[model samples]
Target: MPRFHLVSDPDDPVVAPFRAIKERDLVGREGLFIAEGETVLRAFTRDAPQRVVSLLIDPKRREKLADVFAGLPEFTPIYLAEQGVLDAIAGFHLHRGILAVGRKPPAVAARDLLASLPARAMVLVLCGIANHDNMGGIYRNAAAFGADAIVLDADCCDPLYRKAIRVSVGAVLSVPTARLSRDESIADLLDATGFEGLALSPSADEILATLKPAARTAVLLGTEGPGLSPDVMARARRIGIPMANSFDSLNVATTSGIVLHHLRFLGG
Candidate 1:
């Protein structure tokens, strides 16, 4: 069993890893990311434990976290600390009272991911989604909608960003996500895989509810302000969510959820 440490001060040497989480430079130096809350931390470890470096939990909550930690390798470290100490050390109070430090793993590759998905899979392709919260929300929606994979264009934000992970409630780990980086490349790949590129835009002529979902579908999304690039939109079939008001374009995440729900499960 990995021994748990009791840290009582913000200045404790043991707290360095926790403090580095918010600092990009420091996180890069240490090659670690901080996962907060019991649910997220448990999900992360359950999915990939070898990458877990250490865990910090409030002394009061140790028992509750013990069951999850029990199955982890004996080499993993679990630390227990007073609430004050954890709060000070983390540079902010972690209400969840538990946080885990883990290494960032390599991202999935688009080609490999596509090849692995089933023929009838539904994929969400984000063209330039730059918001972390939106990215996380989309991932949550993707999982809820039973999407097989998520594809990002070059301009998209990092799905593994701390805020993204938090907003996603760690659903990012549950879904397969990869970057495509180029419109042409993505179009070619979709064509080759027999997946139709269906663009989701407010300017689209066709309503989402009207069209039948394809066996292999790629729902192309764009950024909040500008939406999809013309070049990218040109290669894909245009479809829009039917709305009551003209100015009522939903947030990219909300739109994605609505579209995914309608296109993936509802269509079939």
Candidate 2:
């Protein structure tokens, strides 16, 4: 079991990283990230325990969380605080009373991630996806439907952002994710790997369900309002979901689930 430490003061030097976490997360935390709530904590500890740096929790729940502590590395610090002290440290009311500091793993090349996939693979390529909630939701879809990996352009939001990780229910922790460098074309690498790009667009001539699934496929999605730019869509074939009442678009995350579901069980 990891040793537990007592911390009554919010300004304690050891707790500095947890102070004003919201602001630090937005500005970037030097490769570290904050994970909140019980479910998110469980996912991190179970899937990526090596990434954990430390944890801060309310004392009242220690008994219930004994197993979680037991699973951590021997040197990992577990800090205890009363609920009020926890609130003061977080600079806001923290009802869940469970938080962890985790380190982001080093960047992996996009080609490296794609090359590791199985022969028949399905992946999601995200372009200009700046919303954390949507980023999280899409990851959840990717995990649920067995997407082999996720690739993003430089314009996408960080999937490790606290809210995005929480909203994804830790799917981001499980999925193999990588982002394209500024000059890299998402299409070139995908084509080189023999993966067909299926860009999601409302103006496309082909409806989504009508097409045959490719042996290796990448479903490309973009931001809500503007959708995919022609250049970014590149040489990919465009596909669209037919909606009732002439709705031209659906939320990107929702569209991912629909598209992935069809591709997964039906062949894509």
Candidate 3:
């Protein structure tokens, strides 16, 4: 069992990392992120145990989380605070009554991550995906469809953001990920790694359903308003999902689910 530290003071130094969470959320907390809710905490413990730094909980909710606590390392600190104190410390109401501060793992380069995949692999590549909700949705979809990994450009929002983690229900922890440097060409990297890069575009003549899965495949998705950049579209094999009644576009997350689901069943 982990040692339980009782916290009554809102300004306690031990829980300082969690102070004014909303304000901290905007700037982010360096390499550390808040994992809120029992579901997300469970995912963190199960998927990325080593990254867990410490946990804070409402004393009343402690009994309900016995199973989850059993999986945590003995060295991890567990802090129990009353709901009022917890709210004051967090600067917001935390109804779920469970939170964990976790550290981000060392990043893997896009090329290195791709090279480490199996002979047959499917990867989700994101360009300029700034919204945390969309990022989380894409990760959730990727995990559900058995994607080998996810690659994000440097401009993409941090997947470890608390809202994104909760939106994905911990998929951000489970999915393997790599980030591309600003100077790195996402297209060039995927092509060089022997991945057939399929760029999703509304204007493409080829239908996504008609394409066969390659030995190694990377599905490239872009931000909301403007789709993939012209440069990416030029280098990648452009494909589109067929739509009726002239519906030309879908949200990137929804599109990812459809494409990944289709690709999952395709014979390589």
Candidate 4:
């Protein structure tokens, strides 16, 4: 069992990283991100244990999380506090009584991540996806469908945001991710990486169900309101999900789930 340090005072510097969690969530300190709830923490423990820096728990829930604590590194500090103290420190009522701080690994180049994939691979490419919730949901879907990796353009929101990590149930930790350079175009990168780019758009020449999957496929998705940019759509083979009664669109996350699920079982 890791040693539990009692943190009674909300102002304790040891727990400062967690102070005003909601307000400072987007501001990661020294590449560290906050992981909330037991489910996300468990995923982190199983998938990225080395990234865990420390943990904070309500004293009443300590015994309940013994297995979790036992899995951490010996040097990891586990801070215990009463519920009220914990709530005060976080600036909200943390019903789960569990929170962890984790570090992000060094950024991997998009080309390098793509180059490392096997011949048979499915990749999800996001362009201008600014909503963190949608980003997290897409990552969860990618993991579920066994996507090789996710490549995000510079415009996408940070997947490491606390709510996104919580919403994804920690899929962000498990799936390999890379960001595109400012000068890179999503279509050109896919082409150079030897992937057949399929851009999902409402107006497209081909229906998604009609196209055969390639040995290496990269599905391109865009922001909710604008969809893919004109340049991006022009560069790739445009495909659309068929809807009845002229219903043209779905949420970007939901569309990704449906498209990824279809591609997962597509025999090359």
Candidate 5:
């Protein structure tokens, strides 16, 4: 069984792994992530079932979390502490009253994630999307809107970053994601997969409305300021959401949500 220990200080050895996750290069490695808050913790337990490694929660929250922990593997640790102790050891006030660390699960290739879908699918490809909040928001929307999968191009921030995981409310764990080590590899993968790589930009004459819904599409987005890289734009067919004001461009996450919703409900 996973070890359960009471911690009196923030520097407790048990908390070291949580602190290290902030600066670690965990992607594509065998390690895992730290997920905080009751919502995220419960979600992880629900989705993974047998994968949760350890859970540190305020003793008061245990009754609430019991259903989430039932029928899991015997080694899964459900560590409990006083509210004050839990908060102090976490290095912050407990917002959701719980935190858990899970081992990284095996990942699928970018091509495989898309190919597994049976019908025309709208997937998201992020190029240089460095903001964890933006990535999280995008992932939340992707899951809500039925996007097939998410692909991160080179130079993007880690999807498993603590802020990203919290912002995503642990939705990143449920959605399939693949990170390409190089930007060129993403373009090559998309081309080889027969996905219509459509770059979302304000400069394009073609809008989401102009496209047919039946087409298998991959929407490529970038950060708010620089937008999609020139190289990525070259590889993608230029398309816009057709805003009324000439000066306004939707935030990348907002644009992604709108586009995904349109595809999900309107098939456009």
Candidate 6:
């Protein structure tokens, strides 16, 4: 079991890094990110224990998550606090009473990630998806539907954002993610990697249920409002989800679930 340090004072030097969490959350934290709640903590310690810089949790969860805590490296720093101190350090009510500083894995180029996929793989490609909630939901859907990898263009939000990780129920930590550089086009990467693209757009002519997906397929989606760009749509066979007589669209994250579900389990 890892050693536990009890910290009653929120201003303690050892816990300095966790102070004023909310105000600084959106700002960059170098290469580290804060993973909140129990589920994400489990993933952080289990899947990438080395990346977990430290942890702070209320005494309430110390015993409850004993196995998780026990699995940490002997040198890993674990701080224990009461509920009040926990909230004080976070600058808000942290109902879950769990948090950890995690080092992000090294960035992988889009070309390298896509080229490394197996012959029969499903990939989720995001273009300009800026919302953290949407990023989280899409990651959850991708994990549920067995997406081999996810490719995000430069405009997308960081999937490692704390809220995104919580909303995804820790799926972001487990999913294989690759990001495209600023000047790179999603179409260029797909074409070079031999991934048959299926751009999701409301104006598309091909019905989603009718097409037979290729062994290596990429489901491309854009931000909810503008959808995929004309150039991106042209690179792949455009496909659409049938709408009702009046309704024209769905949320981008919801669309991911519907499209990825069909591609993995239903008629593609």
lDDT of 6 by residue, 103-169 (tens): 8889998889889989888999999999999999999999888899999988899998889999888
Quick one: best lDDT, which candidate? 3
User: lDDT tens string, model 4, 1-268?
Assistant: 5678999999999998888998897556678999999899999988988899889998888878888888888878999999999999999998989999999978999988998999989999998888889989999999898999999998888899988887788999999999997798877788788998888876777887767878889999888778778888888877878788977779889999988878877534
Of 2 and 6, the candidate ranking higher by lDDT: 2
Model 4 scores a TM of: 0.95
How do the candidates rank by TM-score, highest first? Answer: 3, 2, 4, 6, 1, 5
Candidate with better TM-score, 1 vs 5: 1
Clashes of each: 0, 0, 0, 0, 0, 1
lDDT of 2 by residue, 64-163 (tens): 8888888899989999999999999998999999999999988888898988899999999999999999999999999899899999899999999999
Q: Of the candidates shown, which would achieve the greatest TM-score relative to the real structure? A: 3
Off by over 4 Å in 4: none
TM-score of each: 0.89, 0.96, 0.97, 0.95, 0.87, 0.95
Q: What ordering of candidates by lDDT runs from best to worst? A: 3, 2, 4, 6, 1, 5
Tell me model 6's lDDT, rounded to 2 decimals. 0.87
lDDT of 3 at 252: 88
Cα RMSDs, all models: 2.4, 1.3, 1.1, 1.4, 3.0, 1.4
Between candidates 1 and 3, the one scoring higher on lDDT is 3
Local lDDT at 22 for model 6: 78
Q: List model 5 lDDT by residue over 104-205, tens digit each.
A: 767667887777766677889998888889989998898888788898887888777777878887888788888777735667787777788888877788
| TM-score pick, better of 3 and 4 | 3
The Cα local distance difference test for each model comes to 0.80, 0.89, 0.90, 0.88, 0.75, 0.87
List ranges where model 1 is wrong by over 4 Å.
Answer: 9-14, 25-31, 182-184
Q: Write the per-residue lDDT of candidate 1 for residues 139-193, one digit (tens) a residue.
A: 9898787889898888887777777878888877778878875544777778777
